[model samples]
Target: MPYKRIKWLILWTPTVTIALWEYIRHTFLLPYLSMDLGNALAPVIVLTVTVTLVYKLFHLLEQTSDSLQRERLAKAAFVEREQLARELHDGISQSLFLLSVKLDKLEHTQDKESVQATAQQIRKTVKHVYDDVRQSIASLRSEPSMTEVQWMQSVEEMAVELRLGGLQVELDWRLTDSDLTSKEKIELLAIVREAMLNVQKHARAKRLIVNAFKAENISAGGFNCTIMDDGIGVDDPALEAKGRYGVRMMRDRANAMGWQFEVGRNDSKDNNQTVGTVVAVTKGG
Candidate 1:
């Protein structure tokens, strides 16, 4: 029961009991010393007890409410910190990648030109940025994305929870033979992971189908992951927009990769109302 209801019981039970006792004593002990003293003393004692009991009950309720609120606030703070750390790792590290690429192009030349010397300076600067980004990433969050095997492992682990919950999920993936950087892997994993969570939550999905492929989109290349589920569809037009930081996090990861991010409903041939959400990451447009 809620604290308010408990308080109501506490207040009313005592008041009723005291009133019944006074009525009985007055009716039965009428001939005894029914003096001004008894009349004055009985009311004073009853009021004192009522005040004391009500105060204590209120104090208990106040303490419990404060403790629960403190716990909720602490949890919110922790989640906020984790989100900030993830953003710094995924966002700040991109500069290091660009710097490293430029430095590499400048490094390999038999020609002892000013460009070569400038390349050395650029290499040194890139190294500094790389070290800082790595340190911050270590302090933040990640899942390796460098190889196909690691990417698959990350996806499987992410879905292990659903398996534990007894949901039937089928995950299939295809990767480009080309290797990806660690930062790219994290971006891909975070984006895919967020989409998976949405499927588990709003979809009420008993069965899920995930297909990932690597392909070129125009001049840009990207990894595409399509998730289909036999679950209830959402009606909100702004579900993708006004929803919490989940969509924001997905978009942020996609932005860092210069990838196009698309997600929403599509056709279900079985008529069991299976809907799909596709997240295509292409070179940033």
Candidate 2:
């Protein structure tokens, strides 16, 4: 039976049974039994029925709740594993593939300068793959519940990291902790960190701005997070060659959470000139 129905039965069954017993005792049983005797028996009968019925109903309700909780935990674990697999495929696996290709090129190369360049590329690819592995391990070990202050601190840390690379960074965060769940905060922080890394490595911009706020234009309960850089814009071939994997991972993460992800060139309003690149992740609309 459904949970609500079981609760209703538990609540009303005893009362209804007592009322019916009283009506029968007064109307028919009184002819055969004394009024005092009937009244004395009523308490014992009601107590026995209520205890038995309530015990059985309570057991059923507890079982139903436990089953639902187990199902939810199982589903959440499955989704987490799937996302981890995708991250490995997009980040480390692709980097390893590129590393193999570079090794093959190194074998055939005869010139000294070319060999040095290929070896350098191999080392860079290996370092990137190593970083990805470490990041995955850290994520697996991270606490599941993150406070609002911790979330903000994580974002600030990313900004501080970028500053060390000689890029000017500004933050304009408006969304409160209530705006997103624990899982949502983790995924959003990952996306933002990826965007900042892209800017650090490939944007070649003098300034970068990060913004997070509720966006009415998107939809009800919608949020917008944008990372803007005054860099070479979306037309840069270097970003396409080196930063494509990170971008793909970001998009995949956002899509997995049913959010919108977009990357485009930031353009001037008065003129048609491209100013920089904008990476946005939005929820709802």
Highest-lDDT candidate? 2
Over 4 Å off in model 2, which ranges?
A: 97-110, 141-285
Local distance difference test values of all predictions, in order: 0.63, 0.79
TM-score of every model? 0.45, 0.51
> For model 2, what is the alpha-carbon lDDT of residue 227?
91
- Which candidate comes out best when scored by TM-score? 2
Model 1 per-residue lDDT tens digits across residues 15-63: 7757876777688765774667567767776777667876676777788
What tens digits encode model 2's per-residue C-alpha lDDT throughout 1-285? 887888898898889878988999988888998979988888988888877987888899899888878999999998788667755864576567556656777898899998998788788779988987887777753544675226777568657646744688989999888988888888898788778767866678888889999987877778999998888888545445753778877887899899999887878531333458999899987
Over the full model, what C-alpha lDDT does candidate 2 score relative to the true structure? 0.79
Give the runs in model 1 whose Cα sits over 4 Å from its true position. 1-138, 141-150, 176-179, 216-221, 240-243, 270-273, 283-285
Model 1 global lDDT (CA atoms, 0 to 1): 0.63
Lowest summed lDDT over 10 consecutive residues: which window, candidate 1? 89-98
